[model samples]
Target: MRVKPLYFFTILLLFSSLNNAYAFCGFYVAKASSDLFNQSSQVVMVRDGSRNIVTMSSDFKGNVNEFAMVMPVPTVLKREQIHVTDNKIIEHLDSYSAPRLVEYFDENPCSPPVMYKMMPMAAPAMKSDSATVKKRARSLGVTIEAQYTVGEYDIMLLSAQQSGGLLTWLTEQGYKLPQGADAVVGSYLKQKMKFFVAKVNLKKFNQSGYTRLRPIQIAYDYSRFMLPIRLGTVNSQGQQELFIYALSRQGRIETTNYRTVKLPSEIEIPSYIKTQNKFADFYRDMFRTQVKKQNNKAVFLEYAWDMNWCDPCAADPLSNKELRELGVFWVNEASNKPQISQRRRPPQQGQNVYLSRLHVRYDRHNFPEDLLFQNTANRENFQGRYIIRHAWKGTEQCNAANQYFKSLTKRQNQRAKNLSNLTGWNINDIQKTMQIPQRSASSSNEDMWWKDLWSQ
Candidate 1:
């Protein structure tokens, strides 16, 4: 039997906007670079069995007329299978799974240990178009299989027999095919992948009266669970940052072709970082450090948790309606609630929703192939949680208080070292910045003076 070509579409838009996007499991600070080449691209992939739904949000910042996208899909999508969704849903998902910082205060060590039982914490949360005269497309060996105007996007399903022909046809039609894209396009063509191309319909966009472009959602069924990032890397500037939010019925989703490493998390850092509003910088630097440690060849898992609950939620868990809107087909409207047994009560509203946040900084040299993924049975919860422990500030003269003060100095020094190791910041500079007093060598000797005197 002949295999059918997977229809993929590319949006020809410069993804360069800064709208408080989320990266993997953390919010991409608005202050980060918003340039298309510098900013991050966000993708939400929902997989159940062989069905896959993808929602892509671009940060395109240029003339709307120049905006276009080309995506490779596994199968041709019908009008019903394609929809334009509000950007807020993507933002909500980002916020729900984002890496979070939780603050804890240390109680007075001198106080009697209150046998207070700890209560459990509650948990929280593409298109294209076509056109053309028959002669040019035919000469280029590009065929327009279908066309539709979905929402503000003019979409087209195209099949090209040759990459050179497709390139010529795209250029002839005024689509700016990036240099060095021909090889990537040729590779996809050899695999019989179809292209879905889309551009913003100015009239529709103006009529819709939306200031920014919304995300595009597409649904299809194919055995391959992968994302094509090679196109985005072609003729690109430095490394490109991509955030993938993978939702699946199974546990966490990870990259199959590359090593999927979890980001450093649940570490106690200096409390001053919170007051200094340096969490964003800290995360950025720490992420860079991890990428460097991995030799820039691994995908970092920022967060992996079930959708039912969160320890300290970054944002409220997405409702069933929101998940459905985001193209989670398995969510049943009537039975959206979790299954309850006579022995146990359900924890949250939704059931069997697992989200994996994968962040990757990629370049052509490091990521030569598209990303392949596999859903695993490992359901262990993980989050990029940074803790801030406020030191006790009591002046009590009890024996416990005295020991606490002595240990406090050691703890603070360790915190400084942790910060320096995670961010590659100078240890002395970090100490200076945090106003931490440097420990003197003489003070260390003073603590062991008896031992030193005996040895002499």
Candidate 2:
């Protein structure tokens, strides 16, 4: 474990406004993956009433022996309440919930237009410690409630009477905490929260033969539905990126403290974004623009839909078995909810698992409080989907074709403007890349009648 206050152990999108009337087919092309952000963490939270399961994964690129995490929890988790989960499941969920780029090809106007649509493809326990450790902990007003070596981690549940004592104890035990964490830890201590600390057991880690650390999951029945992110933000160099995948049996999850704003979605952008790394670049810059637009105080909702199916899926939905592993204990529960619509398939009943993806970019100055979440009754489906329309490339010479080409000019120019507005990219630059001339203030639809006469 890299002892520099395990930031890795911490559990922790803009919309475009070009609303075209064309039918949207979720055609998954590319996505802004979580790895794009260097200082980022991913957390999967499954909530049903007071029962909450939180799985935290970190991208810690450090020595395994130097890794450890100190988390604040409402209750002392037993050995059975903690376990290690496969990282792939979280990756799958990340890809599934990530903001994606979808494309639509324009139908040839000379021929009949068919509705082009694409369908989305779909723990152990531990024992007590030695007497010397107990005596030292008691002297520091800290109680070692429980200890267990679950999987490759040596876990400890602690209740501290004061932050000073806890900090000293942690220092003595080699769990290096970041500076300025004293106050935050003190606040949680005052709230009657218990500290769940874990460090890798080198023997077990070596025996397991895994190159990277698996995510640590904790399950407990508590009334508080909040995640302690303040601790993770302490001693930060700059704003940190956090992707929260919240799953609930009731409905979507929203932050109670901060504004939970849905990112601009289902909008159209320039077709050139489909080439090379433009989509990824477009997403990253667009997200940065939204962060600035919201002043970095808003939590962005990237995706919220029934997990039963996804149209233009970035990845297949997690199986019930995977859901169960991620702490959706009620995945097997029967429900009367109608199945979400899918292409060429009958609507079957759903698993009632509504997953919400929330992206937050924050720092100590902006986000002073840990994220508090609530499950709402709203089940409206939404996604951060950007569309790129490929104009008709045929050279047929009909009146319908002429009208289509005329409409294409306006569409292409509007898309350029949309891209500029969303990402703050220069309109002239976008048009240049699209190989179209910049639309001037005096430009009109009638003036562009012959723009696309022979080519796209």
Which segments of candidate 2 are over 4 A away from where they belong? Answer: 1-38, 115-130, 333-346, 438-456
Per-residue lDDT over 262-309 for candidate 2, one digit per residue giving the tens place of the 0 to 100 score: 988888888777664476677778888999999989999989988887
List candidate 1 segments past 4 Å from native.
1-38, 112-132, 334-350, 440-452
For all predictions, the C-alpha RMSD in Å is: 8.3, 9.8
Estimate TM-scores for all models: 0.85, 0.84
Per-residue lDDT over 41-103 for candidate 1, one digit per residue giving the tens place of the 0 to 100 score:
688888887676788876655556656767766555688878899988877777667666777
Provide the clashing-pair count of each candidate structure: 37, 9
Compare the candidates by lDDT and give the number of the best one: 2
Per-residue lDDT of 147 in model 2? 92
